[model samples]
Target: MSASDPRPAAPRAAPALPGVAGNPRRPYVRPMAGWWLRNPYFVRYMAREGTAVFVAAYALILLVGLVRLAQGEAAWNGWLEALRSPLSTILHLVFLAVFVFHTVTWFEVLPKTMPPLLVGGKRVAQSAITAGAIAVAAAASLALFGIVWGLTR
Candidate 1:
């Protein structure tokens, strides 16, 4: 290749997959400082991922309960006994934290995701929407707890 060859400079490596002019996708690049914290997408992803962890743990608790029921009354009692174990206690605590965090974030995002509810010719405010949702969630949870308590007795 002669120095005088009439050719454009070698095109820069194509930006990763589905590359766009302005929003180039850099799939494998390491996130720079604060990228994880500052990026809204990453924040949402982390919150969702953490919630999944807690859900899995909670499912395991339910699974043990089911197994206990399958094995008759004695096994069910043992399952309840195991529930008092320190490890299970810790797991439940962690799950409670994650569940609350997920609920808060999901509610916060509801206004953005949902269409505005109109009442009496006026659009409901986002804060009001969130508050209403929280109230409904609390009521449902209490109802469920009561029903479960009733059934177990």
Candidate 2:
């Protein structure tokens, strides 16, 4: 090597920590191995899937109701009576929680699956759509509950 070769110095990496050896950009927070389980997205996913269990139970309840209705007025009354039972009430409460979760999550994902909507040369957001759907569901549920309660009374 000649003394006067005039070679350029190599580029240096930034320090990892302000006082550490190398890497300047803040260290990215990588998820742990089982991160999916702990991730908010995954939490929502699990909640969404969990709703299925409640849906199944709700369907079973409906099936029981249908069976009782078919048996006779006495049987139907018995089914109604069972619905008023403590266990049934608890199950319904759980189902209601799951149902709300399912409805919210379902609507939250609706905008993603469907095509975008444009009105007045502006793009409508997914959140807005989800909110609208949720509002509609809530209104419908309340209306139905009121009608049923009115009829029963």
Per-model TM against the reference: 0.67, 0.72
Q: What is the lDDT of residue 58 in candidate 1?
A: 83
As a whole number from 0 to 100, the lDDT of residue 3 in candidate 1 is 89
lDDT of 1 by residue, 8-39 (tens): 77878765554455666644667687776887
TM-score of predicted structure 2? 0.72
lDDT of 2: 0.87
* Sliding window of 10 residues with minimal summed lDDT for model 1: 18-27
Q: Provide the lDDT at 112 for model 1.
A: 84
- For model 2, what is the error of residue 48's alpha carbon versus the real structure, in angstroms, after optimal superposition? 0.3
Candidate 2 residue lDDT tens string, 69-138? 9999999999899889999889888888888889999999999999888889898998899999999999
